[model samples]
Target: MNMTSYEEMFDEYVKSSAAYCASLFEATEYFFKANAALEATIVSTNTAKTSTIHSIQEYFETCKISLIKTIDLLRTFQEIHTTIPGEQVEVDFAQQYFYIKKTLSCVEQIIQLFSTVRDDKNLQQQIWDNDDFTTYFTTSADSISQAIIWQCNFAKRANLDESI
Candidate 1:
């Protein structure tokens, strides 16, 4: 089997997305805290407010969208290797830079999205205002930070060394 540049980058990209999927379950706690806060504020209003579960649903929906995009990117990357078979073809790193960059960008976007959604201060403050805001906030923040750590560690292992 020939290892094309596409295969190399695709493998790395799969690792990136797969790690995100694994960590997302753990990541739910962060959003859960944020959602609890958002629900409190939204529910308190006279008008209909988005429920905590609903917001979480929306978030996972967003994650689904990201997943689709990631899978599509993988398919496109895989396509590059499909045309030729049984030949040891060398893939140029320089040549695949754009696709690799795009994959990296997708990973960054997912990480940033997770960070932002999990740490929306206004919603957090509103949700736990009646309770202990400080502890709630700290714990929630820590969860997001951990997610970032998980992502960064995976990147480092893959020799990407990106601090997501």
Candidate 2:
């Protein structure tokens, strides 16, 4: 394959991964909000909150699916890059590696938050209202955004095609 084709593939991978990451982040935020609302409802009402729980679960599932898709896209790009002749590819592998690691770290933070929410149903209020949790969430979101921006910039530079 030609250099242009590889560059095009890389551009697509970066854009697709960024989109998935954005989706994952948004879903997680919604999940937290839904769970917080459910907790408040539970505290105020004596009736079952099955529907609220189900809705929160759906948001959680979306996050998981988006994370998986993003990871798969990164891995596929890496695999393809490695298989291609070195002379035909101009991507900076080191930058790609670090970007992947940084993005994965952000994803791991979300997974940890998910586990915390899943394991302890009683601490929803504390988790949702805590300043530390807010900071943590914001930091993770910022990191993901920075990583995506860096990746897009790198892809543009590598491709030499400003259209991306």
Candidate 3:
């Protein structure tokens, strides 16, 4: 490819990849915000009982936003990878892709689980009924962070310039 063409491809890849990273960060922030809202509701007094349901509602909103962001990022990642082609598909790139795939799977499952209980009269109650909710949520969140870290490490090692 000509130098300008290569530079254009590089710029496209970098922009898309950076967008994916930004979406990931936004999702992570929403996840934490949801967690904090839930926790705050748990510690509130009887007078603030309404806050319980409100907090749960907030959590749902944030979770939905995060899920949407993740889906968008995943699609963008795929397009960037496919369009870039050739040399960009290095070993580290493949590894990072796998990590992202795993993270996407986990996020999908979380969204599915939440969807089933989303319309329940008492979301907090449904969540409380699930003994594994905390463990599942914490583990999934940690896995996502690990996957993002793995992707960053791969990019750095490969000198891909998409690190962020």
Candidate 4:
């Protein structure tokens, strides 16, 4: 509509897009963390990984809610996160980028959001437990770079149109 209104909308879109990116990184981190926790469960009880899995699942939900005001808001604008065919799931990144660039996008967004927050360990731990974010982030940029390379090769072989 108006100039300020446009800026506000652009800002909102950036915030939401950043959130969408944030959730994926959070979920990926949760996946690896849960994987470790699940291993512990298997050794201790030889039982299901239910507790660890549930914990990770809960984290994902918290991430989703924290990322958006409402589910409808998410459905309305998550273009950056693409869906796969057949299952028609709402998700992000190809399997090739699973552990690389795709994951880095999340880490960057979370850091940006958390940078503005102050002294809130509870909130921090809620998205990502403890302070091992740096550990996961150390090689993030490089990994993402590798993913970009793979995506380029894949696109050429598949003869797909350039990504919009």
Q: Pick by TM-score: which candidate is best?
A: 3
Q: At residue 152, give the lDDT of candidate 4.
A: 55
Q: Please give, for residues 1-164, the per-residue lDDT of candidate 1 as tens digits.
A: 55686587657656655654454443344345444645564545343554443455455445444444544543444454444344423333232334323333443443344344443335545434434444443444454445445445644644553333
- Model 4 regions more than 4 Å off: 43-73, 79-164
TM-score against truth, every candidate: 0.32, 0.47, 0.63, 0.34
Clashes of each: 1, 0, 0, 1
lDDT of 3 by residue, 52-81 (tens): 444554654665565566557757776777
RMSD of each: 12.6, 6.8, 5.0, 15.4
Residue ranges of candidate 1 with Cα displaced over 4 Å = 1-20, 23-26, 29-33, 36-44, 52-133, 161-164
lDDT of 2 at 107: 44
Q: Which pairs clash in the backbone of model 1?
A: 37-127
Using lDDT as the yardstick, the better of models 1 and 2 is 2
The per-model lDDT (C-alpha) reads 0.45, 0.54, 0.62, 0.44
What lDDT does candidate 1 reach at residue 87?
40
Q: Which candidate is the best by lDDT?
A: 3
Q: Report the poorest 10 consecutive residues by lDDT, candidate 1.
A: 88-97
Runs of candidate 3 with Cα error greater than 4 angstroms are 46-52, 82-129, 160-164
lDDT of 2 by residue, 25-74 (tens): 56446545644655565565444643344454555455445546555665
